[model samples]
Target: MSYLELEGLHLAYGNAPAVENLNLQAGEGELISLLGPSGCGKTTTMRAIAGLLAPRAGHIRLAGQDITQLPANRRDIGLVFQSYALFPHLTAFENVAFGLRLRRVPDASLRERVNEALRVVGLTEFAQRLPANMSGGQQQRVALARAFVIQPRLLLLDEPLSNLDAKLRVEMRSELRRLQRELGVTMLYVTHDQEEALALSDRIIVMRAGKIEQQGTPEDVYARPRTPFVADFMGWDNLLPAAQAPAAARARAPQATHFAWRPDAVNVGLGEHTGQVLARNYLGEYQEYLLGTPFGHIKAYAPVGAQWPEGHSVSFDLPAERAAPLMET
Candidate 1:
């Protein structure tokens, strides 16, 4: 049996169902991400597991024990919300030691554990600082340290880095992954960001309207998306109308309707197939090229310095094997 299992879990707010018949399982120490757009029940699922909301139906089990009937306080799960949710009056050390204090742990042991957690998140130097005194990234690290200090059986993160700026989000992502690896704690992360999910998860569950559309490893989900929704949601923006795609791609893909490719998957260069460069936006390491192809307005990327003048003609090819087949039927 899996260490954590949600079998046919359902939750509703009064008459309307927020989540329906959801099922998932995670092995011990596995990092799983629930990824989907807004209102897709990613957060709803996490709330159920955390005991914040009681599911109207189905079961939630942890470590082979039935936790479905347990209250939130008894579940032994750690949660970090999108907002830092730090106590405004407490110093970093007190905030991290809050959970330990609740259990009436000895002062000496609480201090030791709190300091250890701070060190793990590289926040020991900021122990005396309050949330207002720290940078966004530092505050987030303090929140993470607080969650870990409890040493819960499972960890739940609901867009924990969303509060940070883009640059700090990237930095915190690395730190979060490093801490998760060192602890080997079972985790369920909820996010709408595909790139973040892909970068951090051991497995991904793509949800839509409270149901799982697909679940797989990063490579499996990206390289072999099973539906048009999956393809578009994963940010595979280059959608090729069937008639204009390579003959082989059209034939092998189901229903012969549509094909999709990642911008990086299509090569923009001199080749037999021609494209008109409608626009080019230069990024630091690379450039995004908007090209009008026979398939439609397809987006292709070229490395920096590989520029084509506006309205200039360029050749490109979407390789047959790498072209992701779309289930448009």
Candidate 2:
């Protein structure tokens, strides 16, 4: 059996369904991300797995034991919130040692474990400092240490880095990945950021309207989305109905209802199709162009040196080989 399993899971808030008939299996030490927009049930699923929210139906099994009805404290699960839920008055040491204290672990043993957890998160020097004195990144490490110190069976992180600035978030992604790998802990990470999911997950589960739209490795989901919703989320900016696409593009997937490709796939300055550049923006590494074409408005990227002003005509192609065939829009 998988290390963690959710079978026929149903979650709701009163009359409103949050997740319906959801099923998932996660292997030991695997870092799986539940990715979607707000209200897509990713956070709700995390809450259910953490035993904070009761499932309207279905079972949750962890490490061969049924935990669907277990109390939150009794279930060996640790949760880190986006807010970094630390007590302002408590020092980092106390915050990380809180769970051990609650369990009545002896003073000597709890001290060793708490110190180790803080050291693992690279916050050993800040142990005597209160949360208010620490930087955002340091406070976040305190929360992680608190969760890790418990040595739980599973860890649930709900947008843990969302509160950080872009640079810190990127840094934490590496830190989080390193911790998960070194500890070999199974984790269910919840996030609305597609890039974060792509960067960190062993597998990505895209959720929509309380159900899974798609689930696969980051490469598979990004390169070959099965539906328009997923294609759009995965950064496929140029989507066209199969009938509206060029003959060559449509020929690549005769049965597809639609086709999608990223801006990078729209090769500019060397194709049979022509379009007027409606607008252009320098995007650091490449120039993005909005082109008004016969088919529709298309977004494409070209090399930084390839500058085409607004109103200029440029030739581009939606190469058939680069298109992702979609069965549904």
Candidate number with greatest TM-score: 2
Q: Where does model 1 exceed 4 Å of error?
A: 241-244, 254-257, 269-272, 305-307
Please provide, for model 2 over 1-329, each residue's C-alpha lDDT reduced to its tens digit, 9 standing for 90 to 100.
Answer: 99999999999999999999999999999999999989999989999998889999999999999999999989999999999989899999999999999999999999999999998899989999999999999999999999989899999999999999999999999999999999899999999999999999999999989999999999989898999889999999999988898888787789999999899999999899999999999999999999999879999999999988899999989898999999883
Q: Would you list the C-alpha lDDT of every candidate in the order shown?
A: 0.90, 0.94
Candidate 1 on 158-272: residue-level lDDT in tens?
9999988998888888788889999989999999999999999999999988899899998888788877788999878987767777887776765746788898888899556
State the displacement of the C-alpha of residue 84, model 1, in Å, after optimal TM-score superposition: 1.1
Measured with C-alpha atoms, the lDDT of residue 252 in candidate 1 is 77
Question: What lDDT does candidate 1 reach at residue 230?
Answer: 86
- For lDDT, the strongest prediction is 2
